[model samples]
Target: MGTQERKALEKQLRRSQILDAARMLLFSSGIDSVSISGISSKAELGVGTIYFYFKNKDEIFAALQEEGLALLYSKICKFIEKEPAPEKQLAGIAEAYYRVSEENKDYFDIINYFLSSPRIFFEPGLKYQIDMSGHKILKIIQNTIATGIETGVFKEAQPGRFSIMFWGTLHGLLHFKKLEHTILENENHRDLYEYSVNKLIDAIRCQ
Candidate 1:
């Protein structure tokens, strides 16, 4: 590649290295314990280099969140495309979400961490970007529900409101997974998740 292109590619690689390092630290230690210097040491790069790519630990964390959300959105889109019917598409979306959590635990953990901690804050622009990424995912669900209604597969309702409830229900169920051995010792977590998804679908399905 040309000199400029090569330099750009190198820069992107460096950024990925930083993010990877931060992700490792996040997994090893809680976010409260993560720091810029720790990430620099973990990546085997200078502190200045870490700052060159990211302003601070928060920015690095936000970048990771953005990456995870983008991955989720892409996966959801692909899952939706593969299904022929709107009801099936919603099921596909739920499966895609579970697969992502299983396959990308680091990303999922960081996203979950930030989401559960409302006290954590980001700059307005950064927060907006992350929020928009999330909104895109929700919009897909809302649009699919609207399509199902239009086709007479689902009952008429406010797509936006229902979308929020649907997403929140799935997310909440997934979060309860940690308590499985205690609270759900007699139940299969995956079965419970699928059952919840089906119930939600049934609630909206035309009678």
Candidate 2:
């Protein structure tokens, strides 16, 4: 590779190293507990190097959140591409979400942390980017519902509103995983999730 391209690749690798460290710290500890020094230690990089890539812990955290959301959006798109039916597309979207939580727990935790905490402040630009990332994902869901409606497979309903409710319900149901051994003892969480998804599909199906 050319000198300029090699240097660019190296810079990107360094940034990934720092972000990976910060993600680990965010998942193991809490966001408030993550620090540049801790990330540098976790990454085995110099503090100066960490600062070279990120302005502060908040910046690093924001980067992680943005990266996680983008990854989710990409995964959802891939899942949708693999399914031809709108009903199957919605199910694929739900499965993709669950797989991300199971397989990419670090990203899921970082995204969930910011989403569940409304008190946290983000710069307007960063906030808008994050909001747009989420909106894009929701748009896919909304459009899928609209497609189903257009084909006469789904009952007439407001796609935009139903999309929000659908996503919110799935997200809320996922959180119940923490209660599996307590309130949900003897219940299969996956079964519950699938049941919820099916019921939502049934609700909009033209009878």
Candidate 3:
């Protein structure tokens, strides 16, 4: 590459470093405590460099959250690739969600902030991500429902209403299973996610 290209690439690398540092800090601590100075120090960038990339901490957070969510979606796409059939895809999606939750608790913590927290909601210039998290998994369920209609898998997928019901079912059940164990001792948060999904599939499966 040319000298200018090299310089541009180096600048981009620095920006990514800042972003990565911010995410790590937020995940390690809570978002409420992260500061531009801390992130810049962590990234080895000048404080002014941070401003060049992001207006403020909130903007940095918006970028980090969006990037992490895209990673989740990309991972989901990989899980979908493994399942050649719709039924299997639904199961894989359930499994994928559970595995990702276990592996990236920090990411899910951030996800929760985006989902239910007032911080993301009330903060100006900070865009909260959409509730397409379940959509990342429920695409499989929705597709299965649609394909079922064609090949007699389900009676019919009420497109107007079923997506919400189906996705809401997944979301509600997952959240309950995720938190139930913490509230009570010796309660194992097992494959209730997959089981709940299977039950829904069973209910909707066409005879």
Candidate 4:
């Protein structure tokens, strides 16, 4: 390989290394607890080196949040690929959402942080990118509902609002379970997610 290519590859690797360290710190401790020095310690790199890659911890947080959303968007798109049946497509999408929470708990926490503090995305270009990534994910749900309506499976109504209702319901349940309260504790705790999905499907279906 040429010297230029080697240098470019190394630069990308270094950036990824820094980002990975920041992600670990953010997940282990809340975003408020993550600092440049802490990230440096966790990354085994000097504080100056971290600053060289990221202007500050906020920049790193934005980058990590963007990456998490992009990954989630990709996963849902892959799951929904070319399925003509809208109901089945929604089932897959719902399952994908549950899988993300179950499998990528760290990313999930980062997303929760993002939702709690949306003002962080106010930076001009960053907000656009983050919003576009989120829009893509939401489009999957909206499109599924639109298709279901066309096929007479879903009740005819506003697709956008229906999509929000579906997503909001699931989001509410997921966050509720995250609380320390024992109200959600039961033998079938794990099954609450499936129950939510089934109830949502029933609610949206044509009567």
lDDT of 3 by residue, 66-157 (tens): 66566667776788798666666656666666666678776665665665564444254345234354354446556655775777656766
Q: What lDDT tens digits, residue by residue, belong to model 2 across residues 1-207?
A: 999999999999999999988888887998778788899999999999998988878788778888888888888999999998999999999988888888988888778889878775577877887788799999999999999999998999999999999998888888899999999999999999999999999999888
lDDT of each: 0.90, 0.89, 0.68, 0.79
The candidate 2 region of ten consecutive residues with least summed lDDT is: 118-127
Q: Which candidate model has the greater TM-score, 3 or 4?
A: 4
As for candidate 1, its clashing pairs are: none
TM-score on alpha carbons, each prediction: 0.93, 0.92, 0.74, 0.84
**Which stretches in model 1 have alpha-carbon errors above 4 Å?**
1-5
- As for candidate 3, its clashing pairs are 148-153, 153-206
Ranking by lDDT: 1, 2, 4, 3
TM-score winner: 1
Ranking of all candidate structures by their TM-score, best first: 1, 2, 4, 3
lDDT of 2: 0.89
Better of 2 and 3 by lDDT: 2
Backbone clash count for every predicted candidate, in the order shown = 0, 0, 2, 0
